[model samples]
Every structure is written in structure tokens, then in C-alpha cells.
Target: MATVWSVTSPHPVHPLAWLAPHAARRRAAGLRRELRPRAADEPLLDLAGNDYLGLATDPRVIDGAVRAARTWGAGATGSRLVTGTTALHAELEAELAAFTGAEAALVFSSGYAANLGVLTALSGPDALIVSDAANHASLVDACRLSRARVVVVPHDDPDAVDAALAARTEARALVVTESVNSVDGGLAPLHALHGVCRGHGTLLVVDEAHGLGVVGPGGRGLLAEAGLAGADDVVATVTLSKALGSQGGAVLAPAAVVAHLVDTARSFIFDTGLAPASAGAALAALRVLGDEPRRPDAVLRAAAALAAAAGVPAPPSAVVAVVLGEPDVAVAAARRCAERGLRVGCFRPPSVPEGTSRLRLTARATLTEADVALVRGVLAEVLTLVAAP
Candidate 1:
């Protein structure tokens, strides 16, 4: 059936007339999204957000943001190259580099921007990019923007990456993968992939968005865990919004690579600097992670508990995915969970493959035994309800 238009414009058709049918298709497929504004003190147990360390509401982190706002105003005002660069941004960059063991770091407005900056600045028509099938959307978009020859290998298949790099015709090459798969919470084979990249003389760029605050010693990320941080041929992009409980992202690499991106990365050169408040919050969060190194372990433990409750394998990071096989079923399960006073993530098509829609439950260091029990009961009932005919 044709979608009816409610437009009253004089023109025969609106320029955006195609949007009606597109939206209709999405609604029919149970793929439409709705925004549910959260109350400041909503009393639901949260397992849906990416606050792996639960530092977003911490007093110290809040203080850091307040101080930054008082000292530097609200927004960055202009691009970093213009009037946006502040002493706080520089300090955060240096601290991030030191903490992650990178030679240097460059901050961007967001993790998406950081990925765009690095990929576009490092690769062009003459370069080949080998990307993992399960990489985050930002990296996928980055590859598209790079204008490079891109080949997507199977998820976590280092041999496929090796073959792709070995057969590439371009003089320059980059292998991009996420340290942890965002959908299934699977850890990538970093060491094996890095070895392949080294053999092929390719640079390895790992997105540590999910790993920085939830994996490795003191949450230094999977690269650091694999002893690959600061390697000459390796680069990493991390989001302060995740484990750091702040906003913005950064690229950590050799000094030369950082310098090149600073000069040529359009995403960084043209975008406004990260807000001073975000820089301060991220810095404070990093310090918290250092002072309380057990936080990451707590995250992993919480993830394990959630996974066990959901009947899934233990996750290596804070993301615990429960595959439910159908979008509607997953949505129903999530709704049931919410009704039972538990909030969990429901991922459907475009986020995960069709027929594999699932619940994406995240872990937080602050989750308690009582919290786990609630999750267990809610999940058990929800799963049973969904499984019934």
C-alpha cells in the first residue's frame, strides 16, 4: 500500500517525500526507535548504559566537570586550531598518552570523530584497509570516508587479515579492528592480528572504545594487556565517554602519526575542541581508575554474573550479550525486564544481524549482590515468558 502524505505544501511533492515510506517500512519491521528521556533519579536498576565503571555520577568526576566549567566556560567556542584549544585539553592529552603508554595523543570531539580523523588522515586512494566484519559503525564509516580499498574480513579471523594484507596492491595498508566486539562482547585476537600486520608491514589501528574502561590492568585497554601499547606500528582510538565516564575521544600513536593527524585530519582540524568540562571529567576518571585498580575486575565480575544469569558465556569485558534470535522476541524480553524494575538494552537489525537480535546488557563496577539477584529473577521470568508459545 502507498503511504499517505499529510503534507499541505503547494508543491506536487516534497523533496523529503520519500521519508514517509522509509519510516513506514521501519515501523512494519519493528525497527523504529523511540527516545525515553530518563529522569535524574529514575529508580530503575540500570544495565543498559555504557557506564562500565559507574563513574558518571561520582562526586569527584562531577567536581572535575564543575571546576572546568567555572574556569573555561561551557562550550569550546571554536575549532582547536582557532580559539578552542585550551590548557586543559593539552593536559588531558598528555595524561591520556602517559596512562595508555602511547608516545602522543590527539583529542577529538567524539570517538566517532577520532576514528574519522585517523582513518582519513592515514589512508587514501593509494592505501588498502582491512577491516573486521564486526567493527563498530564508526570504523565502518571511517573506511568509507578514507577512499581506500577496503576489505572486510570475518570477525576475529587473523588469517583472513593476513591474507588480505598479503594480497593488497596498495603501497600503504591499515588493519582496523575493535579490541572488543560491541555486539557480542567478544574479544578480538589482538596479538595474532598484530603479528600478521607486522609481517605485512601494515599499521594496526584498534578501537578501544569498549576496552579502555573495562579491560586490562587498571583498564589500560586490551592493547596494553597484550603488551602492544605504544608499538611503533600500532595506533589506538579510545572514548572518554565509556569507562572514563566523560565525553570525547582520543587517538594514541607514535609522535609522527599524531603530528600527521594534527596537520591533515579534517575531522580534528575543522571540529571544535572537546569541551573543557569533558576533559576535566575524563582526567579525573583516569585518576580514579589508577587509584582503584580493582574497578576493572569488578566490571568483569559483574559481567560474569549478568552473563550467567542470561545463560550466556562469560564476557571478557563489561558488555554481556544475550542472543534471543528474533527482534520482536528480544523487544518483548526487554519490555518485560523493564516492567520488573530492571533496565536492559535491546538490540535489533542493523545493530546485529537479522535473526540474531539480542539483549546487550552492560556491567558496572558499582553493581551489588542485591542488584545481581534482581537481574537473575527478572531475566529468568523474562526468558520464560518469551520462550512460551
Candidate 2:
């Protein structure tokens, strides 16, 4: 008798298999995404990363990381609830809450995890989540994972959020939005949304990834600038990766909400704690920002200059998006800038909510006048090259 073996078919019969065709279409449209790592000593002028304050590699930040690593081990051994929580984590959380003017704060491994922890922990089957159409992918995924009735309202439209909440009479409601849109660098109408949420008795969660270091007095964040930081119904999630130039995130809210998350948020309970080094670095960066109040002004000026030179409108925050009219055009423009020793971000569909492809440039406080001139020149050449045909 011959031995028999079973073979499985590679193809699936479900409609989801059609995703291959969609992916191929995206490739044909030059919307394929790829990552290219930079060399440690790369000479290129970087305008792609979210290091708004240019402190990621600062000497003080590096020293903080070194000190923390020397004191604590490199990796957190377990989830924060178990053996992972350290004195550094507690100190960072306390300082962050005080700095952001919130009653309590919970740190997570990343901003994505922070969003997930907050949305999933606060909302459930009986909750209605009204989200902005232009929100980050993390928030969108959180809404989906929360098992809540999610209504995606028009981008930055407080009236739409109000109507959505008004229609949901009995459910616990959450209004979620980004303080500064990642793609276009446009500021959201946070004040108006706060009013809408207040009227509807809804909890408002603001993702301040881009707004923290570039907006408000002393770079406190959009919520602080809008005078909503300590509001009982409002919560904020922010990334330490951007302005803080670290590698973690934090959710700031009322003490009760923070306590609730510690008990109920699966992401917080199961995820490994943020590295001790990142916490120390972020704390040092925050202190530096507090001492040097003129950093945000420098970033804003650089952004304004770049926007004007690229023939794009100035961004309200530190990001300046240069529209290239089409997907292939945007890719080509970004490539040209890269070739010219300038690194810029290329945004296409899916990443861009409006489906308009553009080049996303992040302005840094450390960018000098000469660096700004180089950026202007490279952008001018790339735009001209793309526009020619």
C-alpha cells in the first residue's frame, strides 16, 4: 500500500481573495508602500520623521537613556501589571500627568497601543463611538475592535459629531478625533467638538500626536491651547516619539478612568512595559521643552518657510504637506528629493484620508536657515521635474 498525503489548495473561495487584485491595482498606480532604512551616518537632510523638536539624538536625551539603561535592565521583563512596572515608569507617568494638566496618566509601549487601550477599555457593545473620518488608523482600528457602534463623521465637523451623538439617545457615547491631521497638517476644531461632546454628555478622546509639540503656549498641546486639558469628559493620548523624541505613548485622563484602564484594558494588562530608557529620555526631553519655550516658534518658522518655498500653504503645525496633484507625481517628486540628498515623506491613498497624494515634510526646531534653503531648493527642483510632463 502506498502512503497517502493530503494537499491543501492555496487559493480561497471567499470574496476577500479579491484583495490580491486590489493590491495589484495599487502597485500599478504607483501607490505601493516600501520602507527604506537610513544609515546611522546618512548625510541626507531628513524632513520625513516626526522629530519636531530634533531631540531624538540630542546629547541630553542620549545621556538620559544611558543612565536609565545602566540603572535598569534593557528590556522590561514582564507586563506592567506583573513584574514590569518600575520606579522610572511611575515617575514618568506622574510627571506626564502633571505636565499635561490631567488628573492621571498611563504609559503604553506606543501611541497605537495607547489608543487601543483607551478605546477598547472605555467603550463596549453598549457604546456609540463617533469618530472623525480623517482620524489615524490606530483610532479607527480601536473603534472596530471595541465592538461599539461607530459612526464616522465628516472630518473636523463638530456639527456632524453633534448630530451623530444626538441620534444615539441611550448608548454611552465617545467622540474621537485627531488634534492635528497627520496627512494635511490641518488643525482640528477641538474647541467646537468639546462643546458638542459636552452637550451630548459624551466622552471626548483627542489624539494629539502632531499637536503636542507644535501647538499651544509652551508646547503644552492642542487640548491645553483650547482650554480643555482638565475637563472631566475629555481625555488625550499622545506619542512620546514625536516631540519628546522618545519611544512610548501615554493616555491622560481622570484618575477614575486611569484606574479603570489599569484593571480593564487588555492592551495595558498584557503588553510589555515601555523600555526604562525611553521613559527616562522622554522625561528629560519634557524638562528640556519646559525650559526652552522658544523651540516651537523655531519649528513654526521653519515650516512656514518651507511651505512658502514649495508653493504650498503654511501648515498650522510643524508638518508641511506639498501636494503633487497625482499619486505617481507625488512618488516621483519624493524620489527626486531623496536623490538630491533630501529625505521627505510620500503620502498616497489610504494613508491620506482625502485620497490626495502629497509630500509630507516635518519641520524641526534644529533646522537652520541653510537647511531650510536646501529643502526649498530640493522641493523646487522636484516639483518642477514632476510638473514638466
Give the top-scoring candidate (TM-score).
Answer: 1
Backbone clash pairs for candidate 1 read none
Highest lDDT scorer: 1
Query: What tens digits encode model 2's per-residue C-alpha lDDT throughout 1-389?
Result: 98464546575365476899998998998878887887999999999999999999999988888888888889778899997789999999998888888999999999999999999999999999999998999999999999999999999999889889889955699999999899888999988999999888899999999988789888889999999997899999999999999999999999999999999998899999999899889988988888898898888988999898789888889989887667888888888898998999988878874457899999999998899889878877878888885
Superposed by TM-score, candidate 2 places the C-alpha of residue 261 at a distance from the truth, in angstroms, of 0.6
> Clash number for every model?
0, 0
Alpha carbon lDDT at 89, candidate 2? 93
Task: Please list the residue runs of candidate 2 whose C-alpha ends up more than 4 Å from where it truly belongs after superposition.
Answer: 1-5, 8-23
State the lDDT of candidate 1 residue by residue for 1-389, as single tens digits.
98787878787696887999999999888788899999999989999999999999999999999999999999889998998889999999999999999999999999999999999999999999999988888999999999999999999999999899989999999999999888888889999999999999999999999999788778899999999989999999999998999999999999999999989999999999999999899999999998999999999999999999999899899999988898888888999999999999999989898999999999999999999999999999999999999
Superposed by TM-score, candidate 1 places the C-alpha of residue 283 at a distance from the truth, in angstroms, of 0.5
Among all windows of 10 consecutive residues in model 2, the one with the lowest summed lDDT is: 3-12
Q: List the residue pairs that clash in candidate 2.
A: none
What's the TM-score of every candidate structure? 0.96, 0.95
Q: Once model 2 is optimally superposed onto the true structure by TM-score, how far is the C-alpha of residue 48 displaced, in angstroms?
A: 0.1
